[model samples]
Target: MNEREEDLRVPLISFLLCLCVLIGGIFLFLYLFVPNLSEPWFPPIALILIGFPWLLWVLTYIYTCIKRCFGVSRNNTDSNRQISRRASTMANSRMARNASTTNGSNNAKEKQAQLGSASLNSSHCSKSEDPSITSSQEIEMPLTTSAPS
Candidate 1:
């Protein structure tokens, strides 16, 4: 299984176990505590109704956790894509600058231009100040139906 699918497996199993425990406890409680109320079906039926909300809560929790994993990966992917676009743009700009500089060198008493193209090429190709810094910005968003688009 992939990461998101793996993420759900443990939670789902735990939820099932919890539901079983809850239902078992409800029947146990009715058997022991509710003395003289002897109905064969009422105990199981009561357990089903009472344990339903707990089951729903567990299911919701599992779903939210799985969604959060996807959410984080998606944000990272979008940021990485944006950074790659910028890098490509910068590289193309520098290449155009270099090509123009090479072609314009034949004029008599030609002087190298600082701001024209050469300087821009040098500036962009220079080593980064911090190599470990990622271009992606992380923003916290609520993981719910009511979250902003």
Candidate 2:
């Protein structure tokens, strides 16, 4: 209650003081130009002086009202950016998970290929009937040396 009252008091006092000043200025103008009141230029100048501030205030009020209706603010955009950033992060993490899964499957396939080749070698060795060709014997291959530098 006290805070609200403090907030209202300053603007109320400032507005009253401004109103007093405007009215004093008008009164002074009237006293000085009483004889020229019938001049064609007086009414328009006086009306504009009095009406312009009110016109600006009405425009400002309407602007605020429209802004409220549209529900636009800095916080909304910041939160939306945060949400998009989080979604992108999640998508990146999911892609990483998928890539790791794919790599694991590829490794598993390589292990299966190695095991099948090993089994084929074992079967070929078992089918060999020659006594000279034993499983433990290692065939030697000649290595060609690069031409003498």
TM-score of each candidate? 0.27, 0.30
Per residue, candidate 2 scores C-alpha lDDT tens digits across 1-149 of 54445677769866865775586557557746785554556556666656666676799899989986787674675465445444444444444444555567675455445544543343333434442343123222111111111
lDDT of 1: 0.52
Error of 2 at 25 (Å): 5.2
Off by over 4 Å in 1: 1-37, 72-149
Model 1 TM-score, 2 decimals: 0.27
lDDT over C-alpha atoms for residue 89 of model 2: 44
Task: Report the C-alpha lDDT of model 1 over 36-137, residue by residue, as the tens digit.
Answer: 764587577667756766787899999979987766665675565456545544554554455556666543113223323533343232244322222211
